[model samples]
Target: MDFSFSDEQRMVQDSMRAFARAELLPKYTHWDRNDEFPREQWLKMGALGVLGLRVPVDQGGQEADCVTAGLVIEEIARGDFNCCYGILNSCFAGDILGKFASPAVKDTWLPAMASGETVLCVCLTEPHCGSDAAAIRTQAVRRGDSYVLNGEKSGVTLLMVGDAAIVFAKTDPAAGAKGVSAFLVPLDRPGITRHPYSDMGARGIVRGSLFLEDVEVPAGNLIGPENGGFSRVMQTFDYTRALIGLMCLGAAQATVEETVDYLKQRQAFGRPLSTNQGVSFPLAEWSAKMEMARWFCYRTLWLRDQGLPHTRESAMCKMQVPVIAADAVHDCLILHGHYGYTKDFPVEQRLRDVIGQEIADGTPHIMKIIVARDLFGRDFV
Candidate 1:
């Protein structure tokens, strides 16, 4: 596989980096503090074609390959972590709808989604079932030309602002995994309710809970076949989880930056902090991990472009990147000492945000399990 990025790719990366610095970083902390979603930035992302990077051009997308998507997202994440979460769902939503939604549904939604006029979130995690999505209890009952969706979805990102969601529910409770189905439901429906779920990090990501009380969507809103949606959701994950890995690399890059800034001025034993091997070793280890993790992400993306099976690579990158970032955040905190614990400093916020990522796409333990399953043929315990 060609690991080198083309000139066009480099230009895209550089342009996104510049845009992120100018547009995202300056306002990032303010949004975090105020718990605000920057709709303006999301629009800017749409104008730049950043929101539809990995989506198909036939569906009003830029037709970006997976690596290009990773490049765009990594730059945004490096400058503002929440930008990663927002851009991620922005693009992934359109991708899912384009791939699975019916022609009429796509024709209705894809144009608005591509233009950033509409926002979207995925509703897979029920209050009871999270990563184990097959355990979803949300049920959809057929009611002559409509499906009545009834249940509550939790840990929902972008719900407060999203216009549509790919809601997961059981079409037949007895069928287990085969029973899971997805519906493209609008947030404005009368029976649907969205409320904020306050949390420790990624404040602008706007976490919320979605409640469905006999919410009705047209039969045409069904995405893929009834009782066969788990495959679609996992297919979406196969494309997206790598992007989350790159997001972790961005947070690690920021933590390394804080380390560099503090080391020049911080004193220990009448010398600079960098002079101490105790402080420097962890940072050095983190540096190695980040560098390798970056390349691993790119390679996995390239594999995705080649239509290769990259599930194991995505799981490995997802598992390792956050662990490395967490370690770097741990040291960067001690480097700041008391200042780190205070809200006045950004490191404290960075710490919480990176830790929150461990559970964002898939848990670290789950990633390891995925890798093992991929390697050992599902027979080995």
Candidate 2:
């Protein structure tokens, strides 16, 4: 496959980089310190067509390919890792709505989401089930023209400010994964409770628990065929995992650049620290890894665009990129000395932020399971 980015893709990447440098990087620290979501910047991204990367143009999105979406996310993450969630959620949730929701629902919600007037969060993980999403116990029972939802979703991103959520719950308890279904629930509805987490990183975007106690969702909000959402939701991960990898790489790339610059300027025994093999070698290694990972991520996205099976590639990208990013950021922090350990510097925050990616989407262990299942066949594994 050709690896070169097209002219349009190059323009999209350049535009995102410029926006990040001028708008996001300057204020990311303030948002992190105050635990504030930069809603204004999110709106700016929407206005710039960044939030609507995957949504069809007729639905107020750019109708861009998956690789373009990944490029936009990588650039944004470079400026503020937390803000990349805006893109992730928009694309993930929007894709579902665009594909399965009724025309009315799509017209009503997708445009708002595309314009940043509404934020969408996804609810899949329950209090007891995360990696084993098929084991989720959240129940949605049909009652008249609505489904009354009950149970809690943990580690839900953007819950505090989300206008709506694409919630997955068990519609038929006896069928295991086949029993699952998806619904678009409005967050303002009664019987919904949100409890935000005080997190180690990505503080600007709230991660929280969502409790739906007899929450009434209109029957019209059901997404996809009833009892058939598990496969659909799982398929979206092929796209999202690759984007997550790119996002982590963006953060890692930033830290590596900062460390390299510091090393070049930091004096040690009458010469630059960068000249020393001890200081430079590790940075060089990490830089190479990040570059390789970036290509891997884009390749996964390219596979999706070609309508090919990318489950293995996506799993590999998710498994490797975040770990590499976290290590790179950690080393960058150490290379900066005590100043990097303090909240005064961004490296410490980058380390914390990228570390969370190891758990997001799917853990390394889960990714390994996927890769193994593919390689050895499910029964043999």
Candidate 3:
């Protein structure tokens, strides 16, 4: 198997890395502190083809493949770990609409999203059910030409600033997993309310809780088939989980890179801290793990573009990158000694932010369960 990036892919990685370092790094803390979502950054990245990478050119996108999309994500992450919020906002909702919605729906949403005029959030996780998606309690009842959605979806990224949400709800609660359905619901409606989520990290992310109390959506808003939404919801993870891996992969890379810089600059016993094997060896180990995790993520994307089943691979990547990232960040933090534990140094924030990735896409335990199910049997889960 050839493991080289094409000219276009190499250019994508290099260009996005440059852009992210320039735009995202300087303001990472400011956005986190001020609760600011960069609308202008969205427009800028859209101009750079960072948004809607997979949509057709006629629909105002770059018309790229899944591999190109994954490369863009990985590069964005390499610069600013929190940039994954933008990636998921653009790709997850957009890809789902492109694959499952009608032409009219495509004609309406894709153009604006591609141009960065609108941003979308996915509302699927509820307070009661997270990784166990089939156990959701939000119900949407069909009325005459309309569906009244009444449920709360928690942990929705960027819901506080988004224009719309691609939400999942139970249309036939009795049918269990087959009962779920997807809908594109506008956030400006009467019954929709957004509340900010107070969390330890992801200060750069605009996490929010969505309450849809009798939110009436047009029947035309239904995104896929009536009762077949569960599969679509599951499929949405195919785009996001690996990107989450890339996000943590970026954080892991940042941890090592920053620590290496600190070791060179900081003198210990009248010598550079990195000169000692005690410091150098562990950093080397973290670097090794990070490099392996990075390739695992990209290779999974390659397989995905090849139309292979990547569920098991994604789970493993997601599982491994966080452990690597969390360990690397914390280990590097310890290398910094006192400064690492302080917020002023930013390593602490990197540590805090990387911790969230372990639970976000799927819990570490959930990923392990997926791996077990794949290796042993489906009944293992």
| Tens-digit lDDT string for candidate 3 (83-128) | 6677766777667888888777778888888777788888889999
Q: List the residue pairs that clash in candidate 2.
A: none
- Show pairs that collide, candidate 3: none
Which ranges of candidate 1 are over 4 A from the true structure?
A: 267-271
Off by over 4 Å in 2: none
List, residue by residue over 1-381, the lDDT tens digit for candidate 1.
456899999999999989988998778678888988878888887788887775568777887888888888888877788877766775676667777789888877776776777888888898877878789899999999999999999998888888989899999999988999989998999999888978888888788999999999999999988987888778768657778878867766876886788887888789997887877787887788788888988888888899998889888888887777777777788877788888776777777878887888789888889999987888893
Better of 2 and 3 by lDDT: 2
**Candidate-wise lDDT, in order:** 0.83, 0.91, 0.82
Candidate 3's TM-score reads 0.96
Estimate the lDDT of model 1.
0.83
Cα TM-score per model: 0.95, 0.99, 0.96
Number of the top-ranking candidate, with TM-score as the measure: 2
- Candidate 2, residues 1-381, lDDT tens digits: the string is 578999999998999999998999888788889989889998998899888888877789988899999999999998888889999998897788888998878888888898987899999998888999999999999999999999999998989999999999999999999999999999999999999999998898898999999999889999998998899898998789999999999988988898998889989899998998999999989988899999999989999999999999999998898999899999999999888999887999998888889998889999999999999999998
For candidate 3, what is the lDDT?
Answer: 0.82
State each candidate's clash count.
0, 0, 0
For model 2, what is the alpha-carbon lDDT of residue 241?
94
